[model samples]
Target: MSREFLPGQVIVYPYLWAWQHERGETEGRKTRSTSVVVAVRGANDGLTHLALLAITTQPPEPDRIALEVSDIECRRAGLSDFKRCWIVVDEYNYDVAERSWYIEPDEPALGRFSKAFMMRIAAAFGQASRKSGRRVNRTE
Candidate 1:
Protein backbone atom coordinates (compact mmCIF):
# COMPACT_ATOMS: atom_id res chain seq x y z
CA MET A 1 0.00 0.00 0.00
CA SER A 2 1.41 3.35 -1.08
CA ARG A 3 -1.24 5.73 0.17
CA GLU A 4 -3.51 5.65 3.21
CA PHE A 5 -7.19 6.53 2.76
CA LEU A 6 -10.41 6.31 4.73
CA PRO A 7 -13.39 4.21 3.83
CA GLY A 8 -16.01 5.73 1.48
CA GLN A 9 -13.50 8.17 0.02
CA VAL A 10 -11.77 8.35 -3.38
CA ILE A 11 -8.13 8.96 -4.15
CA VAL A 12 -5.67 9.04 -7.06
CA TYR A 13 -3.24 6.39 -5.91
CA PRO A 14 -0.04 5.38 -7.66
CA TYR A 15 0.41 1.67 -7.01
CA LEU A 16 -1.17 -1.62 -6.13
CA TRP A 17 0.30 -4.33 -3.92
CA ALA A 18 -1.16 -7.04 -6.15
CA TRP A 19 -1.18 -9.47 -3.26
CA GLN A 20 -2.08 -13.07 -3.89
CA HIS A 21 -1.70 -15.16 -0.77
CA GLU A 22 -1.41 -18.34 -2.79
CA ARG A 23 1.27 -17.03 -5.15
CA GLY A 24 2.88 -14.15 -3.25
CA GLU A 25 2.68 -10.36 -2.97
CA THR A 26 4.11 -8.23 -5.73
CA GLU A 27 4.13 -4.43 -5.56
CA GLY A 28 3.39 -2.01 -8.34
CA ARG A 29 5.59 0.92 -9.19
CA LYS A 30 4.78 4.59 -8.66
CA THR A 31 1.92 4.94 -11.10
CA ARG A 32 -1.32 6.81 -10.74
CA SER A 33 -4.61 4.96 -10.58
CA THR A 34 -7.97 5.85 -9.07
CA SER A 35 -9.41 3.77 -6.25
CA VAL A 36 -12.43 3.97 -3.96
CA VAL A 37 -11.91 3.32 -0.29
CA VAL A 38 -14.22 0.50 0.72
CA ALA A 39 -13.39 0.24 4.43
CA VAL A 40 -10.92 0.78 7.24
CA ARG A 41 -11.72 -1.78 9.88
CA GLY A 42 -9.80 -2.17 13.11
CA ALA A 43 -8.98 -5.72 14.14
CA ASN A 44 -8.94 -6.96 17.72
CA ASP A 45 -5.16 -7.24 17.26
CA GLY A 46 -5.09 -3.42 17.03
CA LEU A 47 -4.08 -3.30 13.35
CA THR A 48 -6.17 -1.35 10.89
CA HIS A 49 -7.35 -3.18 7.79
CA LEU A 50 -7.91 -1.34 4.50
CA ALA A 51 -10.07 -2.39 1.61
CA LEU A 52 -10.52 -0.62 -1.72
CA LEU A 53 -12.34 -0.83 -5.03
CA ALA A 54 -9.99 0.03 -7.82
CA ILE A 55 -11.22 2.33 -10.58
CA THR A 56 -9.38 2.81 -13.82
CA THR A 57 -9.15 4.87 -16.96
CA GLN A 58 -9.75 1.66 -18.89
CA PRO A 59 -13.12 1.24 -20.53
CA PRO A 60 -15.77 -0.58 -18.53
CA GLU A 61 -15.65 -4.35 -18.94
CA PRO A 62 -18.48 -6.87 -18.65
CA ASP A 63 -19.02 -6.50 -14.89
CA ARG A 64 -17.43 -3.12 -14.22
CA ILE A 65 -19.56 -0.02 -13.71
CA ALA A 66 -18.87 3.43 -15.07
CA LEU A 67 -18.41 6.30 -12.63
CA GLU A 68 -19.18 9.83 -13.71
CA VAL A 69 -17.11 12.61 -12.18
CA SER A 70 -16.94 16.17 -13.44
CA ASP A 71 -13.76 17.83 -14.69
CA ILE A 72 -13.48 20.08 -11.67
CA GLU A 73 -13.98 17.14 -9.42
CA CYS A 74 -11.28 15.22 -11.26
CA ARG A 75 -8.83 18.08 -10.84
CA ARG A 76 -9.69 18.39 -7.19
CA ALA A 77 -9.08 14.68 -6.80
CA GLY A 78 -5.53 14.94 -8.19
CA LEU A 79 -6.05 13.25 -11.53
CA SER A 80 -3.29 13.97 -14.01
CA ASP A 81 -5.56 14.19 -17.03
CA PHE A 82 -9.15 14.05 -18.20
CA LYS A 83 -11.69 11.75 -16.58
CA ARG A 84 -12.13 8.36 -18.20
CA CYS A 85 -12.84 6.05 -15.32
CA TRP A 86 -14.74 2.91 -14.42
CA ILE A 87 -15.20 0.78 -11.32
CA VAL A 88 -14.06 -2.83 -11.00
CA VAL A 89 -16.88 -3.87 -8.75
CA ASP A 90 -16.20 -7.59 -9.18
CA GLU A 91 -12.99 -7.39 -7.19
CA TYR A 92 -11.44 -5.63 -4.22
CA ASN A 93 -8.37 -5.89 -1.93
CA TYR A 94 -7.33 -5.48 1.68
CA ASP A 95 -4.12 -4.49 3.44
CA VAL A 96 -2.78 -2.87 6.57
CA ALA A 97 -2.31 0.87 7.06
CA GLU A 98 1.29 0.26 8.05
CA ARG A 99 1.91 -0.82 4.46
CA SER A 100 0.58 2.51 3.14
CA TRP A 101 2.04 5.95 2.62
CA TYR A 102 -1.21 7.86 2.69
CA ILE A 103 -1.69 11.46 1.78
CA GLU A 104 -2.43 13.25 5.02
CA PRO A 105 -5.94 14.54 5.58
CA ASP A 106 -4.51 18.06 5.61
CA GLU A 107 -3.14 17.58 2.12
CA PRO A 108 -5.15 18.45 -0.96
CA ALA A 109 -7.53 15.55 -0.53
CA LEU A 110 -9.41 13.53 -3.10
CA GLY A 111 -12.18 13.16 -0.52
CA ARG A 112 -15.29 11.02 -0.65
CA PHE A 113 -17.73 10.94 -3.50
CA SER A 114 -21.09 12.61 -3.34
CA LYS A 115 -24.05 10.83 -1.75
CA ALA A 116 -25.45 10.14 -5.17
CA PHE A 117 -22.22 8.63 -6.40
CA MET A 118 -21.82 6.54 -3.26
CA MET A 119 -25.36 5.29 -3.65
CA ARG A 120 -24.55 4.25 -7.19
CA ILE A 121 -21.43 2.44 -5.99
CA ALA A 122 -23.39 0.61 -3.35
CA ALA A 123 -26.04 -0.39 -5.86
CA ALA A 124 -23.44 -1.59 -8.30
CA PHE A 125 -21.81 -3.58 -5.55
CA GLY A 126 -25.11 -5.26 -4.77
CA GLN A 127 -25.63 -6.15 -8.41
CA ALA A 128 -22.14 -7.51 -8.61
CA SER A 129 -22.73 -9.61 -5.56
CA ARG A 130 -25.81 -11.16 -7.10
CA LYS A 131 -24.06 -11.72 -10.40
CA SER A 132 -21.26 -13.61 -8.69
CA GLY A 133 -23.36 -15.41 -6.10
CA ARG A 134 -21.25 -14.11 -3.22
CA ARG A 135 -22.26 -11.85 -0.38
CA VAL A 136 -20.75 -8.38 -0.65
CA ASN A 137 -19.51 -7.39 2.78
CA ARG A 138 -17.51 -4.42 4.10
CA THR A 139 -19.60 -1.75 2.40
CA GLU A 140 -19.42 1.81 3.66
Candidate 2:
Protein backbone atom coordinates (compact mmCIF):
# COMPACT_ATOMS: atom_id res chain seq x y z
CA MET A 1 0.00 0.00 0.00
CA SER A 2 1.25 3.47 -0.98
CA ARG A 3 0.15 6.97 0.01
CA GLU A 4 0.44 10.36 -1.67
CA PHE A 5 1.22 13.52 0.28
CA LEU A 6 0.83 17.13 -0.76
CA PRO A 7 3.17 19.96 0.03
CA GLY A 8 2.44 22.06 3.15
CA GLN A 9 -0.13 19.58 4.42
CA VAL A 10 0.23 19.40 8.20
CA ILE A 11 0.61 15.80 9.33
CA VAL A 12 0.93 14.61 12.91
CA TYR A 13 3.06 11.79 14.31
CA PRO A 14 1.95 10.92 17.83
CA TYR A 15 3.92 9.21 20.59
CA LEU A 16 7.09 9.94 18.69
CA TRP A 17 10.05 9.70 21.08
CA ALA A 18 10.98 13.36 20.80
CA TRP A 19 13.63 13.00 23.55
CA GLN A 20 14.56 11.78 27.00
CA HIS A 21 14.92 13.79 30.15
CA GLU A 22 17.37 12.18 32.53
CA ARG A 23 16.44 14.30 35.49
CA GLY A 24 12.71 13.82 34.99
CA GLU A 25 12.43 10.14 34.06
CA THR A 26 12.74 7.33 36.62
CA GLU A 27 15.86 5.13 36.64
CA GLY A 28 16.86 4.42 32.99
CA ARG A 29 13.42 4.92 31.54
CA LYS A 30 13.29 7.27 28.55
CA THR A 31 10.58 9.82 27.86
CA ARG A 32 8.52 9.56 24.69
CA SER A 33 6.18 11.97 22.85
CA THR A 34 4.56 12.86 19.50
CA SER A 35 5.31 15.38 16.78
CA VAL A 36 3.54 17.30 14.02
CA VAL A 37 4.43 17.34 10.31
CA VAL A 38 5.32 20.80 9.15
CA ALA A 39 6.32 20.24 5.52
CA VAL A 40 6.87 17.60 2.79
CA ARG A 41 9.25 17.65 -0.15
CA GLY A 42 11.04 15.86 -3.01
CA ALA A 43 9.71 13.70 -5.90
CA ASN A 44 12.05 10.82 -6.59
CA ASP A 45 11.67 9.79 -2.94
CA GLY A 46 9.70 12.41 -1.12
CA LEU A 47 10.87 13.29 2.38
CA THR A 48 8.34 14.14 5.09
CA HIS A 49 9.69 16.90 7.26
CA LEU A 50 8.14 17.54 10.67
CA ALA A 51 8.31 20.10 13.41
CA LEU A 52 8.39 18.22 16.71
CA LEU A 53 6.56 20.58 19.01
CA ALA A 54 7.58 20.73 22.63
CA ILE A 55 5.32 18.97 25.11
CA THR A 56 4.96 19.23 28.84
CA THR A 57 2.75 18.05 31.64
CA GLN A 58 1.92 21.70 32.17
CA PRO A 59 2.48 24.26 29.43
CA PRO A 60 4.92 23.42 26.64
CA GLU A 61 7.58 25.75 25.39
CA PRO A 62 7.08 27.94 22.36
CA ASP A 63 9.98 26.33 20.46
CA ARG A 64 9.78 23.31 18.16
CA ILE A 65 12.21 20.63 17.05
CA ALA A 66 12.50 19.76 13.35
CA LEU A 67 12.96 16.33 11.73
CA GLU A 68 13.09 14.75 8.26
CA VAL A 69 11.15 11.49 7.88
CA SER A 70 11.22 8.82 5.17
CA ASP A 71 8.16 8.36 2.99
CA ILE A 72 8.39 4.58 3.28
CA GLU A 73 8.44 4.64 7.07
CA CYS A 74 5.66 7.21 7.19
CA ARG A 75 3.49 5.03 4.98
CA ARG A 76 4.21 2.07 7.21
CA ALA A 77 3.10 4.12 10.20
CA GLY A 78 -0.10 5.18 8.37
CA LEU A 79 0.66 8.85 8.85
CA SER A 80 -1.78 11.30 7.29
CA ASP A 81 -2.82 14.90 7.43
CA PHE A 82 -4.20 15.95 10.86
CA LYS A 83 -3.73 12.44 12.19
CA ARG A 84 -2.07 12.19 15.59
CA CYS A 85 0.75 9.60 15.64
CA TRP A 86 3.79 8.36 17.53
CA ILE A 87 7.29 7.08 16.67
CA VAL A 88 9.92 5.33 18.79
CA VAL A 89 13.55 6.35 18.70
CA ASP A 90 14.86 2.97 19.87
CA GLU A 91 18.36 4.41 20.17
CA TYR A 92 18.96 8.09 20.66
CA ASN A 93 17.62 10.08 23.58
CA TYR A 94 15.93 13.47 23.46
CA ASP A 95 17.61 16.35 25.26
CA VAL A 96 15.82 19.66 24.95
CA ALA A 97 18.59 21.77 26.40
CA GLU A 98 21.12 20.34 23.97
CA ARG A 99 18.94 21.21 20.99
CA SER A 100 19.36 17.70 19.50
CA TRP A 101 16.05 16.33 18.18
CA TYR A 102 16.77 14.54 14.89
CA ILE A 103 17.23 10.92 13.88
CA GLU A 104 18.52 9.37 10.64
CA PRO A 105 16.02 8.19 8.03
CA ASP A 106 17.61 4.74 7.79
CA GLU A 107 20.85 4.74 9.69
CA PRO A 108 23.13 7.59 8.76
CA ALA A 109 22.80 11.14 7.49
CA LEU A 110 26.12 11.43 5.68
CA GLY A 111 24.63 11.42 2.17
CA ARG A 112 21.05 12.47 2.89
CA PHE A 113 20.11 14.49 -0.22
CA SER A 114 21.10 17.44 -2.31
CA LYS A 115 20.45 21.00 -1.20
CA ALA A 116 17.79 21.21 -3.91
CA PHE A 117 15.42 19.17 -1.79
CA MET A 118 15.55 21.80 0.95
CA MET A 119 14.81 24.52 -1.60
CA ARG A 120 11.83 22.54 -2.84
CA ILE A 121 10.46 22.27 0.70
CA ALA A 122 10.90 26.01 1.15
CA ALA A 123 9.06 26.70 -2.10
CA ALA A 124 6.26 24.41 -1.05
CA PHE A 125 5.91 26.30 2.22
CA GLY A 126 5.78 29.57 0.32
CA GLN A 127 3.03 28.27 -1.96
CA ALA A 128 1.02 27.06 1.02
CA SER A 129 1.29 30.43 2.71
CA ARG A 130 0.11 32.22 -0.39
CA LYS A 131 -2.81 29.89 -0.95
CA SER A 132 -3.88 30.37 2.68
CA GLY A 133 -3.72 34.16 2.26
CA ARG A 134 -0.83 34.51 4.72
CA ARG A 135 1.38 37.49 3.96
CA VAL A 136 4.99 36.74 3.17
CA ASN A 137 7.21 39.49 4.42
CA ARG A 138 9.58 40.90 1.80
CA THR A 139 12.18 41.82 4.39
CA GLU A 140 14.11 39.20 6.26
- Number of the predicted model whose TM-score against the real structure is largest: 1
- Give per-model TM-scores: 0.60, 0.23
- The candidate 1 region of ten consecutive residues with least summed lDDT is 131-140
At residue 126, what lDDT does model 2 achieve? Answer: 41
lDDT of 2 by residue, 78-120 (tens): 3323133322112122212112233322321111222344345
What's the TM for model 2?
A: 0.23
For all candidates, the clash counts are 1, 8
lDDT of 1 by residue, 1-140 (tens): 34445545665454453333224434434545445545554667555565566666777655445555556545544553755565566555544555455433344345566566666767776676577522222221
Best by lDDT: 1
Residue 101 of model 1 has an lDDT of 54
